[model samples]
Target: AVMDFACPGLMGDLTSFRKIYAAPIGKAGERGASEEEKRIGAARRAELGRLTQGFIHARKADEINASLLPPKTEYVVFIRLTPTQEDMYIRALKQKSLQSMLGRCGKSDAEAPTSVLGVIQNLQKLCNAASLVEASDEFDIDASSKL
Candidate 1:
């Protein structure tokens, strides 16, 4: 069985997985792949897929042991952000770097900067506690809205 904490798609035929593995190793990394190289790589990948058909069998958790698992339920809860959290969140959203990243949304060819996830995490931290995102020693614990 294959498992991943963050990316379960690693077990499937995902384009992101292909992109990660197709990147050249050592000095000739991802940046070295030219348009022609990419085309050839795509052709080779297609041939490999054709040759490896039916070689893998994937099973889901439910399929393995349905009796041991319970039915799934999702819950959504809403809470108002504290004034401090709202202020910090708004400031984070207004930052030029974040604004530029957000502006790229909905573009088919736009590549998301790796830092986007970090920026989002920081924003989430800010909502959880001002101390998490702020470096100041004078940060108040009461600034956390979730508490």
Candidate 2:
């Protein structure tokens, strides 16, 4: 199963985020900002023509010079999609049935491959197991209680 999510500001993977936002030398490590520092945290990024950018609003851009090229602070955003959501689309295609159908079609033996028949058997097994697994995960399902 494949799942995907995009957070524009926080695109890409873990390694890249650290590389782009890591503090330079002589900076204090893991140090919370002072009260004066707290005042500085209000800045946000904005585009400023072709050559430059600002992390503060245009109104505040004059105060936040481009010389502050080394960013003063960093923040991160993360997103995740769980296994079921990832699998939902593929699962909708009736994957097990299709697999069995293909397995049967692929057999070239004169008698046809005996293992192709196993595809249907295995598909049934998978469904049975999945139903049991779903039963375990859901208390509201009455079927689980009987077993």
| Alpha-carbon runs more than 4 Å astray in model 2 | 1-107, 110-112, 131-147
Instruction: Give the per-residue lDDT of model 1 (tens digit) for 76-110.
Output: 88877778778888988888988888777666533
Off by over 4 Å in 1: 1-60, 106-111, 145-147
> Which candidate achieves the best TM-score against the true structure?
1
Cα RMSD, model 1:
10.9
lDDT for model 2: 0.41
Could you tell me the lDDT of residue 5 within candidate 1? 38
**Model 2 lDDT per residue over 26-95, tens place:** 1223366564433333221111121132322345674666556665687775433234423533473467
The global C-alpha lDDT for each of the candidates, from Candidate 1 onward, is 0.65, 0.41
Clashing residue pairs in candidate 2 (N, C-alpha, C atoms within 3 angstroms) = 44-55
Model 1: ten consecutive residues of lowest lDDT = 20-29
Each prediction's total of clashing residue pairs, residues at least 3 apart in sequence or on different chains, is 0, 1
The positional error of residue 123 in candidate 2, measured at the CA in angstroms, is 1.6
- Model 1: lDDT of residue 75: 97
